[model samples]
Target: MLDRFTMPLTHRPLASMARYLSNRQVTPDQVTLVAFLVGMSALPLLAFEYYVLALMAILLNRLGDGLDGALARLSGQQSDAGGFIDIGLDFVFYAAVVLGFALANPGQNALAAAVLLFAFIGTGTSFLAFAIAAKARNVERPNFPQKAFYYLEGLTEGTETVIALVLFCLFPHYFPWLAGLFAAGCLITAATRLWGGYWTLR
Candidate 1:
């Protein structure tokens, strides 16, 4: 839903970052691996009830995530391997954040957390399936901007998730409510993607 405003911004600094990283001889794969490690460490921050620490971890992880693409462009080393690793790490990191919230409030929020996880898994699966099919069919690959259907729409993009991360850190007590809202958004994303895939693929 917000992609129209956000997509243009995504590429603005990428080329500049790519130039810098290339000059430094940084590899895209190396950036991806480092990003994955930072993202994985976030799980422990959440488990230890350090919401602020987790928020910092989220930002660091995002930097790593963003860097891989920049590094790829800088090095002219973009590939299926690089893209696959980047996206795979993204899904895992998202799951870990939700798991962190559950760990932080297991007493009264476990159910909501579980629901959020289900939604995440379901919606993520739908998204990847559609994307893979679209790729196989030689369709114009749908960038997040093109996906009026799922993932990029609603309040679940990187920006909004970061905002939610900040909110979670500030009011960890409100985790349950946030989880429910995220779950609702996930459901809507899933349905929209599925329907869009049918129309586009058929």
Candidate 2:
């Protein structure tokens, strides 16, 4: 939901960083790979109850995510392959974080984590399904021209997801409540997207 608003604020900084990395011979794929590795590390960190360190890993992952896109655009190296890898890894990272919280306290967090993951499936499937159809029909996403996939707006987006993760890290004891709340939001997003996308495509 806040992604569009935040995109402008982040564009200049990410572009500058991208230019610096481009000059240093760093590739977008390299950044994505490194970022995924760092992001995946959060699972073990969280399992061991190292919330702060896990939070750092999560933030760096998001940084790498934005940087990779900036670097792709800066170097004119953007490709479907790069986009595929980036988005694929993103879902895995999100799942891992939730699993980490569950592991932190299975008796309490497990059910919440499960519900959240289920909600994620709804959001992820609806988002991708709409993108696929939109692309097939050449539907333009004017709001997010830089996106490789057709972008859809909803109550829960990347911004909201990250905020939820950050809150989970900051208040580990509140994982159940936080995850449940966020899951509800995600479900609402999924439902709206499904309805809107269907009518738009129909």
Pairs of colliding residues, candidate 1: 1-153
TM-score of each: 0.88, 0.99
Q: What TM-score should be assigned to candidate 1?
A: 0.88
| lDDT values for all models | 0.74, 0.95
Highest-scoring model, lDDT: 2
Best-performing candidate as measured by TM-score: 2
1-202 per-residue lDDT for model 2 (tens digits)? 9999988899999999999999999999999999999999999999999999999999999999999999999999999899889999999999999999999889989999999999999999999899889889999999899988898899999999999999999999999999999999999999999999999999
lDDT of 1 by residue, 1-202 (tens): 6555655686657667767878888898888888788877778888788877788888888877777776776577877777777778788888888888788778967898899889887678877787677667666534542231223234455666666667776788888898788789878877887777778778
RMSD after Cα superposition, model 2: 0.6
Q: Write down the worst ten-residue block by lDDT for model 2.
A: 143-152
Instruction: List clash counts for every candidate, in order.
Output: 1, 0
